[model samples]
Target chain A: MSTATNKKTVQLSHGGGGKEMNRLIKDIFFNAFDNPILRNEEDAAKLHFNGNTAFTTDSFTVAPLFFAGGDIGKLAIAGTVNDLAMMGAEPQYLSSSFIIEEGFAIDDLKTIVNSMATELKRSGARIVCGDTKVVPKGCADGIFINTSGVGRILNDHISVKNLQQDDVIIVSRDVGRHGAAILMAREGLALESELTSDCATLWPIVEQLIATNVDIHAMRDATRGGISAVLNEWASASNVGIEVNESAIPVCNEVSGLCELYGFEPFDLANEGTFILAVPKTAAEATLQVMKTFCHCEQAAIIGHVNDRKVGKVILNTPWGSSRYLDVPQGELLPRIC
Target chain B: MSTATNKKTVQLSHGGGGKEMNRLIKDIFFNAFDNPILRNEEDAAKLHFNGNTAFTTDSFTVAPLFFAGGDIGKLAIAGTVNDLAMMGAEPQYLSSSFIIEEGFAIDDLKTIVNSMATELKRSGARIVCGDTKVVPKGCADGIFINTSGVGRILNDHISVKNLQQDDVIIVSRDVGRHGAAILMAREGLALESELTSDCATLWPIVEQLIATNVDIHAMRDATRGGISAVLNEWASASNVGIEVNESAIPVCNEVSGLCELYGFEPFDLANEGTFILAVPKTAAEATLQVMKTFCHCEQAAIIGHVNDRKVGKVILNTPWGSSRYLDVPQGELLPRIC
Candidate 1:
């Protein structure tokens, strides 16, 4: 069958561990995140740590375990580690659980497990424990992964409720890479420019930021509902309003073009690699500088500021010099893009 | 369509969090588990603690968001808290994350969340932090949940490596309840005897066990591959073999009959609410007595013993005077049952 015909539907081949799987991981996920640890393509991630313990867990069931920029294996590890990073933690260990569809290819599973081991080693994390279960074929789409991570918290004050007035909001690198990549992968929309999913571990960038000792109030990895959801959450949790300069919010040209063509707002899309930092306004520049030292975050910028007025609200200054309310994206703008 | 006509197919209605959902939770989950925390149907479990912290994480993605015993919400809380309990910890706090499908019903979502809150209260655990993501409809089966728990570790020396030669293996209550329940739910099988999934929290039983001070070496919930898988894991981890007296192993009559007819070994089936304990052979009777104080564990029994011979192996003595090897069930025999 031609690639076009096959492209419209997700087949078991998409999840098969082979050349296609490698292409999917490198071309989409690697291209977007572009970090040394991830690029190394090892079985586990190697990390450095300093303080108290931090733990988090995440599960990925992105339909078509094999997606445009990544697969469930990569997504699972990245997601959990990012949560630890958000806490300014140095990830140390991970426990993975697999819920596989009965009849899932054993070879395919081995491939995924191998990839996970590689990613874990590369990120400086170890798989200390794991659980596997098989459900009847029709009961699951293909495969789902649950990863629980433990990290050493480098900074004790890093928390969602730590934000204060005058804190600046800095976004790491560009937004919408993950959302757009998954969209293109699912819709089969070919563009002159290909968009890759920004699925990656943010520990390195987070580690660098912590080392700088720049005052950070809170940090969140913008995953689902993109920047919009995270900002709203931060505003609500910190009891502060946020105002963003639209032009300062970075978005890759390819992603911007795709979002425009698809009638989706980039702010509402998910981003696996991007993080929002709420820092003391005076420390914002230093934070951005430290973040930029990491290639994945070279384009980091202070896009917004926490304000005293309109607490619990997020406002975006439009390109036309108009301000608009940025609410939590009501539902999924782009599904399964993780 | 008539219910009979819908056989062999699972629909979104199964996960809708309404009457059908209640029936599934009660008839299947509650019947098997039959615990006070679950029967109370409150907003969070009221647990008493004495100085130690407990921690655990569980991620659930049943093809049908809702299942025979419970939805991802209840499963998320129960699964994680149980893990903490197995470690002789008192569950106190929990964190939950949801991967929701874009088109999932808002009402259903609310119900699931509320149910989770209720289960948490019933288990005496609090939902302290959480996250939500929406994946496009086809990108996810429906809704998947990952829950991590923090509890105080009350007892010391509960590690698997603590197992000693001649330690007796005690199982709390009947085996294979959860697996059989899921099978019946999936197959839509009806019989004179009803079998429900034993999906419930075991914190109370575990807490009682710890209080009795019976020289427990290790404890594990018999999930996924069931009692056999857990025993095998214990043996391998502790560098010992487990020899079980077949007649001493407790199996519900209905579950036994179902296993026989389906060509399944009860030992290989999953049981969410059941746990395996390795205690000094001399303390087995006392442990069983403590277990009886918990209503759900009235059928607790001393079924096996840890031995130096056949290290890292699991041996079962049959009623017919034959000995057979019980290996980890290769691959998943039942999917999404947990």
Candidate 2:
């Protein structure tokens, strides 16, 4: 659980462009999506592409400008890079726009910009264009970021449409790491064992996939609405049903216990560091092997398989030996947990 | 001067997704950016392009989850299409991502979405992909929008760097209409003479430009930071100085009077319905003649002339027979004035 220090209504410390911000970034966002580009603590992620084009964008507005793990600077870069990777694109150029509240600290602004420059270096993306605006204090929550990315698409053959009926579903790692980490930080929930966020870039994993001839079909980062939302979207888009053995779905023991205590479903919680992949039966083994070379993918597994569109829904075979339909969440179960 | 009614704080009427919203949108955003697609008021903007590809996105977040200016729906579509026009790209496709506040009005959301459908038709763009998220209420200010646009690069000769000294600056008329209108609606700054926003699509203007064989250097829409920011950026980017004759710059009389009362500088004020064109001295006459055929360009004028790099700065020749250097605004003068 998060400590009391984590739960104070969002303060400037969260966006202060200081140590607190770094802690927040590492503890929450970085932990959720761990990967090489992010772990390098660089400005931007560098990626190489063979063909096609990749495009993505991310908007970030954390209550405080600075935080424990990172500030809006790192968040903006990492978020967009991850989005491109989710589409199997080699992240490249980026455009950033800032909406700042009136009377924001100029020093803080400079810090954020410098941090952004640093992260951009790491990410290997150039800031080609940018925009800035100021909103009345009451009209905005300090500073908000909107970043768009354009990358070279690696392979046109890899796409969501390629998913076969019996393709297996694989998650990069444990669930609820991102959501729970944020909750703990936001609510200051105390826990015997500390838990941090799982935010990190997945460019390395994507690179690995591109280098290998794995029969990967669909790929999506499990964020915002979490694993449930992603799976639902994939199922709907691919016109297939999914059947998962709950016990096979990887979940950190600590996260599972925390979710049980909070009455939150691990599957419903958001995870910034995780991604979902659909692979053909024959390619699943090789794909999982490639993924395991990355630290965050060690526990990855094929927890489910695609079904015919006639089955058109998600079902979970629970640990209790009971089967239940998992419907697309109608609304957000954990708001602002991103 | 604005009336007392125009000074009241914004309420649900500003984003209600109804007649009030329509009024607010027309009176502010649309009024500032008047163009063919916007005037049509269709479901999407139809476009014709001859290039590799185009990109666009629209993100909407209206506080209270709704607004008088067609809610998050209309704004999202219009905003994205407009962005494409600024680049002289025919908006071909768009992507939307929604960050909804938890417990928002469901019916309101549907209205916004429906509005987007209509606006997209009017603009002649397609909604190719989308994303939705519900954040806890306090984490967001009702709703925020982020839109991306994609269009073919059009003519290979079009580039900002093409701007040369002696180029004439042409502005789409009625400066500050959108910014001032939004301010009035948002702040309830009522005036005896009602002012409307200039938020419309400029694809037609862009199409017209393509039809004209006149030499063009660069183009930019006066949004966000407005004409002052745009001019300064264009001057710096093109490595040329710009001299604007104050009397020649177009300004709606009502907006001028309001700025006088509010101590805002018309040049520094934001404008959505306006665009700046930099054309070679030789092609200036023909370009202006062609532009005059459009209603939106009625008040268009040759406001300034680009000069050599030695004078690579913006200068204003005042009505008082004096000249003053107009520096790029170091900070935002009007918060959320856009």
Candidate 3:
């Protein structure tokens, strides 16, 4: 019977569901993600959920594990919570499962799990149930996490097809920061400015949006293919044309510089904490006012509008007064950029 | 863009959230797990739930991907749904996330996903949302799958702490087949007799037991640590003693042979589809009758009973009438046996 405190690294026994596995779970996971529901230690969590619930799942396989602003644990929690928040839901319960290599560092695992617990507080979400699996040394990378969330729907009107003609399109914050931060880390670049990933939990800001009763037609977080994917999906799903003023899109100087050097388009670069919304022209000003209250969202701007002029397409109007179709991203830009 | 037929192996572009990614999702996953909710094409799935629910998660990193009788996909689905079943819940919805290596075979992915769909039908569980991520070659062995499930609770009294002094302990089927089969695969053992994993969904049998109104105090699948772990947990949690008759426990000849050759204890080996149940002595016959009607559970047997003779421990009664304590399995006997 070896204590987890004496172990510096994880072994296959840590996942064997034996005495050692229980010790690690208690000394680490239980201590970090402690809650009434999680403390029950049942095979499955018993939860009380009623009416409509938004359910979403995401897996985090970010390279380097630790990034500029956040690590994989923070990303795992924020990613799923944001997915639920995008549906106008109150992030509630989450299940965190880990796939760790045989020789992963115990300290690193604890640090990652601690980050997850801290991030969960942003939305008051609970990690109710979990599973841990360990593979041989070379079977997997250092670690991978999967989180699935279930949230109560506070506003059920949000839908991809709910966009109306003449609706205003809003971007929550500056784009391309997350993609650029990861690229910089992978290339071992030490630039003058300190760039960081925009990865964060958006439920706090979203709760305010819902509480204020903003008539949000649709909402989505710009993740893998960035703002371009979200707008293109909306245009096709709603059978409406989206016109974006390229000059109005907010891109930080750091992100733009990285994009320029990497030959990447800012619109197609991913952002973890950023989101897009569709609102009636009448509600656009109030929406921006509520959004600006959050420091991280102070730069929120109206970059586009929806109409039937070019149905089922996204047209980007450059600052020089020339417009062109903004096609969805093709091929792979960077793998494991999440 | 290239057709999926022409792409023999998955490329990084297949996970880029663009034309190739969309094509891959549609041509492979959507075609296999096709349903209205999954085809809705939203960031999250909208589900309606009332009252108490059971939520659980598991990540499958089983070796060889395909084993004797089941693959990782089938194990992923059954493992999660069985957790819900153990909680006396009606399996309803699931969210699946896949982390695939860059050069994995598309055909193999199709086969695995198709197996998942087939397993889901046994429990009437739907895969409502999914995520796909591709890492560069050598980052992952082949593929890993995570499944999270939400099910409505039908019989809420089934809990590990609900065991009573006079309860009857039951084994749903033969034990240790799953662990033995995996060992056989890994060791390249070619015995004259056939051996396969006892991996299957147990929701049907559980539903029958619920409908029959058998007084099930607690139920758990004999998974990672096999029957030994479950009994020890029940005894410790319920503050009761469990006495098992070694002669009463069922073990297939092939499994016993493997155990003899490998010097492994059958009670400590894992069993995916087998389960343990505790019921009042009065309901023991009725429980066995209900369980025996299922073809897979033809060997259901009453292997033990709960008592206060030795609290917080499990005692094994030998055929010679002597008894000894059955402690929890200690170290990693096998990794990735799930």
Best by lDDT: 3
In candidate 2 chain B, where is summed lDDT lowest over 10 consecutive residues? B9-18
Q: Worst 10-residue stretch by lDDT in candidate 3 chain A?
A: A1-10
On residues A1-338, what C-alpha lDDT tens digit does candidate 2 reach at each position?
24553353233333322234345455544543345444533111223333455555566764444544456677677777777776666676665656555456555666676667666665566654444444445556566777777776664455544566889999899887877776666666635456766667677788888789776788877766567766765666567888888999888987898888888778877676688889889999999999999977899999899987445577888999998876554433444443
Give TM-score, chain B, model 3.
0.97
Worst 10 residues of 1 chain B by lDDT: B40-49
Q: Measured with DockQ on alpha carbons, how good is candidate 3?
A: 0.86
Q: Give candidate 1 regions above 4 Å deviation.
A: A1-53, A63-70, A103-115, A121-123, A189-191, B1-57, B61-75, B99-115, B133-144, B186-191, B320-323, B326-333
Model 3 lDDT on a 0 to 1 scale? 0.93
Candidate maximizing TM-score: 3
Tell me, per candidate, how large a share of the native contacts it keeps. 0.10, 0.07, 0.86
lDDT of 1 by residue, A150-235 (tens): 66667767777678988999999899888788777677763545677788888877777778787778888887768887788778
Local accuracy of candidate 3 as per-residue lDDT tens digits, A1-338:
25664488888999998888888888999999999899888899999987999899999999879989999999999999999999999999999999998889999999999999999999999999999998888888899999999999999999898999999999999998888888888998735569899999999999999999999999999999999999999999899999999999999999999888989999998889999999999999999999999978999999999999999899999999999999899999889987
Model 1: per-residue Cα lDDT at residue B63: 45
Clash list (residue pairs), candidate 3: none
